[model samples]
Target: MYLTSKVVIEKEKIKKPRGLQNTLHDDYVKCKEECRKIEEREITEKYIQYLKTELEAAELVVAQESAALQATSIVSSNNQNENKLDQVPSEDSILKSEKETFVQEENLIV
Candidate 1:
């Protein structure tokens, strides 16, 4: 019985070192994971800032394009109106032409 008790104590002593090593390994893994989380958070923050800057630049481009489109439309509309005016005779010219036609016709008949 004494020999058996001595063997059991020896076995427990051996198991104690393994348990301590496992505990130390677990602590090391936990610390590594925590550090990784912090690094990931910093990378995420930088990425968010980059995306925000890109978004702002895109918005500025869109605004500039919209302004350009508006100006082009305004100029196109003004040109179209000018072309329409050129195609149509003025009221005063039409009335004067009609009066000359009547006078010539009356002179010819007389």
Candidate 2:
């Protein structure tokens, strides 16, 4: 009904139907442009986008969006923390990795 064709009473009246059809047709056509411009308020792109955003915020995965935002902030904060520290791997971590690698090599050679 939204994008459907407008009333074509004028065109129908061309054939000149009688009785109720004729009377209703004349009645409808009498209005100022016959309600063709009934919906005068233009639907703006901004309003439509706002409506869509509101609908998504209300009905869609709001929690998922919040979780994603929190995860992103946490990741960014972690990166910032790492940058602030500006340090290489600690001795224990490096030693642990080296030991793991050596164990793997020994297993391969055996």
Candidate 3:
């Protein structure tokens, strides 16, 4: 009878620690899962913020390029107009040349 009681007490002691270990393991797993979820959320938010920044930068570059193209176009158009004006002669020069040629022809005939 004494040996049987001692064995029973030992079994109870062993069972108690096993139960406590199972509970601790379950709690550890829950904590790890929560940490993983938080990390994933943080990483996703950072990526979203990065993408927004990149989009804004791209838009700015595009706007700058568009403005440069427009300025170049205006400058080129002005230069072309200036060139055309440079090639054209004034009206007074044509009349002076014609009068000189007519007088020369009259002197030749005389």
Candidate 4:
């Protein structure tokens, strides 16, 4: 009877350590899962920041191109106006030609 009680006491001690080890394993898994969640959140935030920077750069490029296009259009319009001005005769030259035509007509009538 004495030897049997000693064996049972040893078995109880072994079982206690096994239960503690199982609880420790569970805690370790939980910590690893939390760490993974934090890492994923950080990566998502970095991606969002990268996208925002790209968008701002695209907007700036678009604005610069629009301004350049407007400047080109204005320059083209001004050049067209200058070309039209060059083709038209001055007022003084027009009056001189008209007076010459009138004198010729009077001579022909005489």
Q: Which parts of model 4 have CA positions greater than 4 angstroms off?
A: 1-21, 88-110
TM-score of each: 0.60, 0.27, 0.62, 0.63
Candidate lDDT values, in order: 0.93, 0.76, 0.92, 0.93
Model 3, range 16-103, lDDT digits (tens) per residue? 5553778878798889999999999999999999999999999999999999999999999999999988985667878998989999
After superposition, the stretches of candidate 2 with alpha carbons farther than 4 Å from their true spots are 1-78, 81-86
**What's the CA error at residue 61 for candidate 1, in Å?**
1.1
Which regions in candidate 1 have their CA more than 4 angstroms from the true location?
1-8, 11-24, 86-110
Q: Considering lDDT, where higher is better, how would the candidates rank from best to worst?
A: 1, 4, 3, 2
Residue 59, candidate 4: Cα error in Å is 0.4
RMSD of 4: 6.3
- RMSD in Å for candidate 1, one decimal? 5.9
lDDT of 2: 0.76
Query: Higher-TM-score candidate among 1 and 2?
Result: 1
CA RMSD of all predictions: 5.9, 17.9, 6.4, 6.3
Worst 10 residues of 3 by lDDT: 12-21
lDDT of 4 by residue, 15-88 (tens): 55553778878798889999999999999999999999999999999999999999999999999999998887
Q: Model 1 shows how many backbone clashes?
A: 0
| 1-110: candidate 1 lDDT, tens digit per residue | 99999999998777555537787798988899999999999999999999999999999999999999999999999999999888878899899999999999999999
- How far out, in Å, is residue 87 in model 1? 5.0
